[model samples]
Target: MQIKHQVVTRTPLGGFTLVEVLASVALISIVAAYFVHIQIQQVQERVVEALAQDVLTLANASMTYFSQTNEWPDQENGDCDDLIATLGGLGAFPVAVGGYQGPDGITLATRCEDTGDLGRTLLISVNFPFGADDQAQMLMSYLPTSVNEDVDDDEGPVVTHYVATPRRASERYRFYRIALEERGIFRLSKPDCPGRRNDPAHILLPQAICMPASAQGLGGYFFDEIDDDDDYWELQLLVADGEENNNVSDFMEFSGIPTCDGNRVYVGAITYCETR
Candidate 1:
């Protein structure tokens, strides 16, 4: 009788191999990263959209308040905090708009009180945030046609007018001007004339001079080089108490200049107020 001993080999069945475990971890990490990226993008888009909407709401409220009360919300030295406080006090600011909290560092650069202009001009500025490079473009799209028009004329040359004429200023659109640190300053200004220079209703003229770049990143061409017939005009706020036909050139010029020390840029807007 030959006793045959069968050898029993037991294979370990409880755990995965090193390669398999690593591959599974990589797959899960990729999936999680992709979904997380998607969520982040969605949130950013919502924030941009919400900001645009909120700014528009604020602009409209300002216009309405001026229309009803015949004056802008008063502020101290055109300070943005003071502007916000004044509006909030008057219940003019929006209550629940997401991402519309008052900016932390914005300050009002100029106001009607400063310029003594009949038309209310509010120049507010803050440090350009890390993620808000697209805000200018976004806000441009929502601007009213009165502010966002292509007034190019084909009569021998393209003519662009910036800063709505006094006639057009009544259309309820806010005009915007942006100054960047790296790119210097650029504005929307009236074209050099023999075009529409002396239009009786236009406040900006053909010969209006733009300020030169100074120690402050303040001076540049009023017209961006890209567009020949741009619609933005160099805005000059004029003050004439009880005088409706005041000359636009006689008033002090409100230079759209930014401060040199900070990483901030100036973003300003003009809205017409019914003073008469």
Candidate 2:
């Protein structure tokens, strides 16, 4: 019995080394970091969507106010807190929109005016504060294609320094107009028009040039800024009915021609001049 007891022995269990433990920790950290990045991106996307919704809300409210009052909520500069308060008072919001607000951190300044017979028009300018370039680009994508094009082209949209902060290269004020009523037709010079001043029958001549006009003094009319150099406008004549010719020479002689192709025109720079 003494001899059997003396012969008994055992081996120790195996465990991970320090390097293996460190490797496991590194792997976990990487996975955690990846998930965190995804979460941050999702958050950014939501933030952009929320901001866009806020703009849409403000636009709808302003339109409502206009429809009810037959006048737009006055916004001289870009800061629209006063306009917001006015809208809130008119019951534009279910819950009162309080505090100074304008599409997340971006500043909004608008210029509303009665464009004579063009009806009332609202020019909402989106100013991206410093350090908001990425956000501005994202916001632009969310805006209407017409607005996005205006901002992208840089030739259109009167750039105003309503926001005092210095802007980044990518950051700029974006503009879009909301027409509350039907646009009024602008009377072209007698030499440019195809029909006589008193006659209505010759209004739609085959090679006539004409356009819907806005008030001369108001911004966002035919051009955002009608300067001295751009005083005399040269527009392309409209193509006559049943005519297959698309040549520029044929229509070049007409004074009423306004558009470059179908949507834009040159006014110091290429700007939008959508035909009515």
The candidate scoring highest on lDDT is 2
TM-score of 1: 0.37
- Estimated TM-score per prediction? 0.37, 0.41
- As a whole number from 0 to 100, the lDDT of residue 122 in candidate 1 is 43
Query: How far does residue 268 in candidate 1 sit from its true spot (Å)?
Result: 40
Model 1 error, position 50 (Å):
3.7
Q: What is the lDDT for 31 in model 1? A: 100
Residues 138-252, model 1: lDDT tens digits: 4345443312223234311111112211233333334444553233334454421111222212222222233344453422223223333344443323222222334433333
lDDT of 2 at 273: 20
